[model samples]
Target: MGGATTEPADEKPAVYYANCAEAKRAGAAPLHRGEPGYRKALDRDGDGVACET
Candidate 1:
């Protein structure tokens, strides 16, 4: 008798793309300036906090 075969799981689930650029070009809020992965896209002066609000 042949047993049931299992397929590899998709490690990268759908949620992985939830916040990806492809998901929303607008992009999500940052984890506070000067933090990790803090792209200076908004902070022109690179001083963190775009306008010092």
Candidate 2:
């Protein structure tokens, strides 16, 4: 028998944005450090500002 697979309750699905414009369009802009959608790529300068327009 195969057991059912499940995700942790605290785990959130990743939201990918092609660029800052896309993220802003979705109202997910100004993402700070350690935020769910925040990534080093988004924060190019690594100043903890993600999706800054």
Off by over 4 Å in 1: 1-38
Q: Per-residue lDDT for 1-53 in model 1, tens only? A: 68987656865422222332432343433324654334556445766643232
Full-model lDDT for every candidate: 0.42, 0.85
Query: Which 10 consecutive positions of candidate 2 have the poorest summed lDDT?
Result: 35-44
Number of clashing residue pairs, candidate 2 = 0
Give me the candidate number with maximum lDDT. Answer: 2
What is the TM-score of each predicted model, taking all chains together?
A: 0.25, 0.69
Root-mean-square deviation of candidate 2: 2.0
For candidate 1, the lDDT comes to 0.42
